[model samples]
Target: MTSTTASRPVGAKPAQGSNLSLGSLLRRPEAGAFLGLLAVLIFFAAFGGLTFLKPAGMSSWLNVAANLGIIAIPVGLLMIAGELDISVGAMVPFGAMTVAVISGHYGMSIWLGIAVTMAFGVTVGLINGYMVIRTAVPSLIVTLGSLFAVQGIVLGLTVLITKSTSVALTVDGPAKVIFGDFLFGGQLQVMVIWWLVLTAAYVFFIHFSPKGNWIFAMGGDKVSARNAGIPTDRMTIVLFVLSSTSAAFVGMCQAILYNSAQVAGGQSFIFNSIISVVVGGVLLTGGFGSVVGIFFGTITFAIVNQGIYYTDFDRNWSALIIGVLLLLAVLMNNTFRKMALSATTKKKGA
Candidate 1:
C-alpha cells in the first residue's frame, strides 16, 4: 500500500509502517550522509597511513570533532526547526571573556564566572529568538545581524574592561577538574566526555521522546505545526537559547582548559559548524535529519580537516585537497539522496 506523506522532506517524520528491508534502510534520511562518512574514513585511512588511526592521531581529530559537534548538533536542531544562529561564533569568545574577566581578572569565584557565562548565552539566545519571532524576518538575516553585533559588543566590552583583547584564566579545584582538564594521559580533552554525554542527551531528546516528534513537525511545516499546538515560537526561542548556550559552554570550557581566552579565535566555528551539519545529512531546507547522521558527519569533516596532517601531501596544497575531498563527499551524499527520492517514488507508484 502507498504510504501517505506530507510536503515534509523524507525522514522529517517516522517511516509510515513497519517494513524492514535494505531499500527501507537506504531510504532513511541519514543513510546517504552515513555512507559518505564511511567513504571519507576509508579514503583518509588509505592515504593518511595507520598513524592517523593511532591514539594520538585519533585524539587530535576526536577532540576537534567533539568541540565542533557540540555546537553543530544544536545548530542542526535549529536548522531542523527552520532557524539559524550565527551569533554562536561571537558567543564563544564572549563567554570566555565573561568568565575570564569576572573570575580570572578580578579574582572572583570561578563558579560565579561560569554561571554568568551561561546566563549571557541565554540572554543572547532570547534576543535572537525575539527579533526573529517578533519582526517576522528570516532567521538567517536575523542571526547574521546578531553575528556582527555580538562580535563588536564582545570586543568593545572586552577591551574596555580589561584593556586587552586577550584574557588569562586560572582555575583549580572541582571547577577545574570538571569543566576543563587534561584527561586520559593529556592526549584527550575533558570536552570529549562532555560531548559524548551531551550527544546522548540529545539523542534521547530527539529520538526517544514526544518532543522529538514536535521538532520534526516544526521542521516539516512551522505554520501547520503551530496550528496543531506545537508552539513554534517557543520552540524556536528555546532552540536559539540552546545553540548560544552550547557555544558559550564550549568557549568557557576552552578557557578553563587552556588557562586563556582570545577574542579573535572563534570565528571559524560559524562556517565549520554549518558545514558539518550539512555534511551530516541535514537538509538546508529543514525537516529531515538525524542526530546520528550529524555525529558521523562531524567525524567525517574532522577527519578531512585533521587527516591531512598525517598524509604526505605538500603542506601548501592541503587546503585544496581538503576542499576537493569534501566536495566529493557532498556529491556522494547527493547521489544517495537521489536514490532515496527514487525509491520513494517507486514505492508510491507501486
Candidate 2:
C-alpha cells in the first residue's frame, strides 16, 4: 500500500526562490496603505508648504492619529473578524465621564478613577460581547443599542450628580506624566508613545503569533473556523472587549489631558475610527486587513483632516476636501489589492 504522507519529505525546503521581490512586497496587505499615506503626506506638504512638514505641524496630526489609532486598531480587528463595535462612540464619553466624576467630582484618588473607568469599560465590553454572542443579533445592532444606552447613562448620571454636562479634572504626579502629559517641548502627547507600543504589540500578536491566524480565519468564515476547532466564541468576545476598552482608554486619557469632559464631544470618534479602518484597507465586509495598514490609514486620515488648516483653502471647504481625498485613497487601495491578487493568481497558474 502507498504511504499516505509520502508527497514531501519532512523539513524539506520549497523549490521556489525567496519571496523578497518587489512584486511580493507589493502583495502585502499594508503596501497599499503605505502608498496612500505617502500620497496624502506629499499632497499636503506640497500645498501647505514647509510649515506642514515642520515638527510642530507634524505633531498636530500625529497627536490626533495617536488617539484615533488606539481605537481604530481594535475596531479594525473586530472588522477583520466580521464584527463591528459602534458602542465605542459612547464608550469614549463614558470613560471620560467616569474618570471625571470619580476623581474630579467625588475627589477620589486618580488611580482609583483610572481603575474604575477601566473596570466600567471592561464591564460594558463584556455585556456587549455576551449580548452579541447569545442574542444572535448583528454586532452593529447590539453595539448600536449599547451606544445609545451608554450615552443616556452618561447624560443622566452626569446631570444627576454633577449638575452639569461638563466635568473638570486635575491630574497630578504619575497619572499625568504617564497618561495625559505632553512630551518633547510639549508638542507630543504621551498617548503617542502608548499608541506606538500598542501597535507594535498588536503587530506581533496578529502577524507573528498563532492566535492571529485564528482571527483571520474567524473573519473569513466563522462557522468553518469553529468547525475547524478554533475558539470563535471566545475570540469574538475578546475582540469586543478590546474595542470597547480601547475607546474608554482614549477617553480617559483625554479627560486627564484636557482637564475636562463634555457629554457630546466623542461622537466624532465613531465615524472617524471607521473611516480610518476602511481607508487603511480593511474591507467593510470583513476578512481582510492588517494592523500596519490601519496605522498608516489613521495617519493618512489625520493628515487630511489637519492639513487643511495649514493651506489657504477656505475652512468651509475642509469637509469637501477630506471626503474627496478619502474616497480617492480607498479607490487606490482597492486597485492595489486587485493588482496583488492578480499577480498571485498568475503565479499560481504558472
Candidate 3:
C-alpha cells in the first residue's frame, strides 16, 4: 500500500473556500438574524445612552424577551412545521384563570391548581391538534376559531365563578420560588431560565435529531413528507399541543409571578408573539428558520420595543419605527435566503 501522507488524502475533498469568509458565514441560518440583532444593538446603544447598556436597562428588554421568546420559539417551530396557533392568546389567560380559579378563588391546593392549569392546556392543545389533523381547514382559520371559542369559554366561566373579570392570588412556597421569583440581584425573572432551557430543547429537537428533518419536510410539503414515511398527522398534532401548552406555561408563570389573572390581558401576546417569531427569521410560509435565529430575532424586537423607552423618541412614532424595522428585517431574511440557495446550487454543480 502507498504510504499515507499528511499533505494529501486520497478521498478527501478540498475545502469549499474559507470558513471565515463573509459569504460562508452569512449563509448560516442565523446570519441574517445576527446581523439584524447587531444593528439594533448598535443603534440602541447610540441613542439609549449608558443606562440602556446597564443591568437595569438590560433587564427591561431581557424580561420582555423571556416572556415573548417562550411563546415565539414554539410558534416558530409550528410555522416551520407549516402551522399556526392564534388560540394561544386565549390559552394564556385560560391557563392563568385555571390556576387562579381553582387555587385562588376556591382555596384549593396550589399543587392542584398548577396541575389542573397544565391539564387544561393539555386538553385545549389536544383539541387544537385533533381539529387541525382531521380537517383540511387552514391552521390559521382553525386556531382563530379556537381563539374565540376559548376566549368565550374563559369569559363565561370566570364570570360565572369569581363574579368578576379579574382574579387574584397570593403565591407562596415552592411555586413562588420556582416559577415566579426574580433572580440575579433581583433583576432577571426565573422565567428566563425556563426560556433558555426550552430553547435548547427545541434546538436539539429540530436541529440535532432526525425529528427535525421530519418537521422541515413537513413544511416543505406535507404530502411528500407523508409519502416519505413521515407521520405528518401525528407531528402536526404534537406541534399544536406543544404550542398551546407553552402558552399555558407562560400564562401560569405570569399568574404566579404577579399573583393575578384577567380575561383580557393576554390578547397582546397573540400579536406580539407573531411579531417576535417573524422578526426572529421564521418565514410566514414556514420550513425556513432556526431556534438561534428566532432567539436573536426576539432580542432584536425586545431591543427595539423596549429601547424606545430609553430613547428620547416620541412614543407615538414607536409603532411606525417598529413596522419599518420589521419590513426591513423580512427583506433581509428573504435576500439572504436567495443568496444561500444560489450558493448551494452553485456548490452542487461545482
lDDT of 1 by residue, 213-240 (tens): 7888898898899999998888889999
Instruction: Predict model 3's lDDT versus the native.
Output: 0.85
Which candidate wins on TM-score?
Answer: 3
RMSD of each: 4.7, 4.8, 4.2
Best lDDT among the predictions, by candidate number = 2
Instruction: Between candidates 1 and 2, name the one with more favorable TM-score.
Output: 2
What's the true lDDT of residue 208 in model 1?
Answer: 85
RMSD of model 3 against the true structure: 4.2
Error of model 3, residue 162, in angstroms: 0.6
Candidate order by decreasing TM-score: 3, 2, 1
Q: Lowest summed-lDDT stretch of 10 residues in model 3?
A: 1-10
Clashing pairs in 3: none
Each prediction's number of clashing residue pairs: 0, 0, 0
- The true-versus-predicted C-alpha distance at residue 282 of model 2, in Å, is 0.9
Task: TM-score each candidate.
Answer: 0.91, 0.93, 0.94
Q: Is candidate 1 or candidate 2 better by lDDT?
A: 2
Rank by lDDT (best first):
2, 3, 1
Candidate 3 lDDT over 84-182, as tens digits, reads 989999999998898888889998888898998888888888899899888889999999999999999999999999999989978998988888888
